[model samples]
Target: MAEHKTNAMRLLDKAGIRYRVWNYDPGDGNIHGTAVAAKIGKPPETVFKTLVAHQGASLFVYVIPVGSELDLKQAAKAAGAKKIEMLPVKDLLKHTGYIRGGCSPVGMKKLYPTYIDDSAMKLETILVSAGKIGLQVELEPASLAAQVSAKYAPLAKRGAGEAASN
Candidate 1:
């Protein structure tokens, strides 16, 4: 497995990209989700989570705000793959070397197509998982995509009650 400072963190620092590291209470592991949004004092829509998926034989990732779920159909369409689905835990581990709770969009074992949900673009700064539980880093969506070589795309929509921007 990767070390404490994951390839993600190293990439950020190497690029001299500015980001703030936030630590929060990960209560029984589930807290990395909504609890992280609250801990950072940001709306759930401004705090994003990293999800790994597959497009044909290739791996893809979606970085979306916590308020929404991964729309697999949208993701597949964006990737131009006939089908797309969540990568199994074993595949996720093999691909990113990070457990499900601490996946980061910045660094991975290989370069996967990265989709940053539209919701994140609404915020001047967004929080993303920092390759470990209880750790997060804040940066602009554009910077994350550029520094990480991500392919910007919309992979999710705001949950039923929220507005359309997400």
Candidate 2:
């Protein structure tokens, strides 16, 4: 079957960046990061998720491993903001033009400052949402950062009771 192209994929193609698309079944109604990693047969640390946060009128994007939670304090420090809070799911599409579980740092309605967890830089390649649910795009970490003008920083923390992936 032919793979469907997403806005993120098209953007990568236009930049001549090479990427591999991974598709998994969304039928079970489980799209959690860990579930996605399992379906894609990759380590949880290698599968990243996009999250949006805001401070006043400023918006920031973060890409971190699915199994890890965003460390709000670290995120705020990285962005040089006094405080940062997750963007509400109800306003996600309006703010970033992406619905929950399908947001990609790339191809957003506008280019907001983007930051990726330094953990991603440790891997040669990382998988992130391909602008749609059930789809992911695997590419070089450096390439992903360059594509989105993102910086790598310590922005992820294992959630309470979660195993450390470090």
Candidate 3:
């Protein structure tokens, strides 16, 4: 197997964090979190998606289960902002140094405050993007949180009319 190094993977290596990388064929550009989870053979609940949000001038990062939605009201409170909205997709790469499906909470253009949904605490490990499409990194939830200085919060809820992805 060939070695592939992404910024996130390098950061983990430098920090001495233990993680396992999984790769899949992206196949025509469908990179939704749920699809990634399926391709990687992990339950969606144990696979996290990184989302960027903004309140006023500050940017925030939210990590939640692939199948769940970020509760904007709860996210706002957890972020200590009056309100929060998802950052526009057009600005994702400029702000985070990553495109939509490849954004990892670990390595970005800058270290913004990061929050992982509290439910992750119950799992032994969680999977997140490896800062590239077709790759994922799996590690202890606590380790990931520590790597990014993330706080745990109740930031996720099942989307309306959607089945839970347990």
Candidate 4:
């Protein structure tokens, strides 16, 4: 079968950005970021997940490595918001034009303030959802940052008892 083209991919193409697409079987259940990384033969550190948080009347986008969790305090600082909370899963599609597990920072319904974890700067390429659950796009971190106007900050933290995998 031919590879699927997502809105995110089309946007990247239109902008003259180069990327490689990877697809995996979603199987009989939901797939998390870590599993995605393994399926694509990439280290967990190189695969990032897009999360939307609501701060006051605004929504912000955060991209962090799948192996780490987003630090809400750090996210608030980066977003310059007094407080922020993850937007409800049910509202993701309405707010971001993508469903849960498939949200990509690019090609959202609107371009919210986007932030990428500073750790990504250390990697040559990173993988993000290609606007779908079974797909991902690999591209230079700097290129992705520039395309989305993302600010780099320390936005992730190792979960309790979770050894750093990246």
Each prediction's Cα RMSD?
A: 3.0, 2.4, 2.7, 2.5
Steric collisions counted per model: 0, 0, 0, 0
Which window of ten consecutive residues has the lowest lDDT sum in model 1?
A: 1-10
lDDT of 2: 0.91
Per-model TM-score versus the true fold: 0.88, 0.93, 0.93, 0.93
99-133 per-residue lDDT for model 1 (tens digits): 88889888788778777776666679888989888
State the TM-score for model 1. Answer: 0.88
RMSD of 2: 2.4
Candidate 2 local Cα displacement, residue 123, angstroms: 0.3
Query: Per-residue CA lDDT of candidate 3, range 100-123, in tens?
Result: 888999999999999999889999
Poorly placed runs, candidate 4 (over 4 Å): 159-166
- For 17-136, candidate 2 gives per-residue lDDT tens digits of 899999988876557999999998999989999999999889999999998889999999999999999999999999898999999998999999999998887798999999988889
Q: Tens digit of lDDT per residue, candidate 4, span 73-135?
A: 999999999899999999899999999888999999888999999889999999999998898
State the C-alpha lDDT per candidate. Answer: 0.79, 0.91, 0.91, 0.90
Q: How are the candidates ranked when ordered by lDDT, highest leading?
A: 2, 3, 4, 1
